[model samples]
Target: MPEEIIDLNSIVSGRQPINSSETPKEVTFDRVHSILYGNSSTKLIYDNAQKYFTKKFDQTYPHTSLQRDLFISIIQKVHPSLKVQFVVEIGSFTGNSASIMGKVLKESYPGSFLLCIDTWLGDLAMWINKAVWEHLSVSEDGRPTVYYQFLTNIIKQNLTTMVLPASMTSIIGARFLQTYRFYPQVIYLDSAHEQGETLIELSLYWNLLRPGGILFGDDWGWSSVRCDLKKFSYMKNLTIEQAGNTWILKKPVN
Candidate 1:
């Protein structure tokens, strides 16, 4: 059989047809705030980062503005008082999410830093299964230049100082953090969504989060992601919460 063709533009434009019968509710700032804070009275930060990403990069990120607000809220809740904060993001594709979070950190906590970890080469699954190879950046030698794009996006947003890049796999990045004894206040896992890989990441990065910190991931609706998160939460004796397409696991304050 011929290879199945996935429309990159359709997915980016949110025009992709749903393959499942169940339709998730639309994610809004109020909905996300309710789930994360249990109340909607708290105002969320409104930034131009999303619009900047859309206009400059022309890529559709899976994360939304509401989700980004939730992230900032969690960060503020965990580390109230504007101290230096450290955030780790396992997947920093095109720097959209990173840009949003970085902008928040820069404005709220002047000395805060964000560590964006990614292979920076397009995922093999996207290349082989989704046939999105052509959408990725290319070098003179025909290699993917995604890392360059990520760097450029951050620099363009004037976030190079706040958002640092780790051009490596998630496992390697986690190991480097461990070796350095670097504990982050918030860790976002949006890398591998396979059940086993997600489990490994949770196990590996869970201890790296400080007390009262948070560990969250995107793609909560995926079977592999949800199943593994449920199992992981059960094993860790933590309650999992949903905000839009994101699943959050907060470390206890003990």
Candidate 2:
């Protein structure tokens, strides 16, 4: 029998493709063109992705309806290059909005958090709507249970790390603002679409935002929310833009 000889040069050049029986050599690899999801250009979209990923359990909260599309688009416009540090959200229904915002921040600033405030008690409609009573068996007395379940869902999603839960009116005090050491970069007012409540939410966070920070709300087309936002814009000399069911109020960039 003749002895077989291997061509070493061909093996090194990959001119001779290795068979399945051949073991490949291991070598170190370099990381080129790394992608940061929530970078300056894509932070808002990144946040929307997080919300979509966790949207299944969000049904309990009153859906934003037409406002959802506005949120998706708005998130896109909010370039991550702005480097807004904190986000404050009023009326964190089932925490869906907060979770979405938190996801965006996580991509750019992993340690950032969203402050979520709500009573968790169902809105006034919950007490008056016959549909809620018939479907979810959510009588006025059962609202607390429904609210509890919403928070439970928030926790199960591992959102507690990014969501700071607070009761209604709790975010107004000086202590709450002092905790951040800096003003919030974005403020969302979606608490109550009712006239009084909407006005209050706006008034509360009006001056609390940093000069370049933004304030937006859902149900912008609604009579109550719209009126309040219009007045707010005129009074503050700020411009309010409506996209779908949401309104955006931008504080002048300083």
Among all candidates shown, the one with the greatest TM-score: 1
lDDT of 1 by residue, 1-254 (tens): 11123221222232232322444333233443343334435432123234322324434544333355787666765744324367889988778788888888888776677878888776655567534554465556767766656766776777755677667788777766654456787888888587777877887788777788888878887899898787777666889978778788878878
Reference-based lDDT, each prediction: 0.67, 0.55
lDDT of 2 by residue, 1-254 (tens): 11123221222232233232444221100100012122323342223434422323544445645244454466445445555556777776566677666666666555566766666665666557866433223445544444444445556666644565555553343134433233566777776588755655576576556666678877766798888777666656778887767788877766
Q: Clash totals for all models, in order?
A: 0, 1
Once fitted onto the true fold, the runs of candidate 1 whose alpha carbons sit more than 4 angstroms away are 1-67, 79-84, 129-132, 140-142
Model 2 per-residue lDDT at 25: 23
Q: Which candidate is the best by lDDT?
A: 1
Worst 10 residues of 1 by lDDT: 1-10
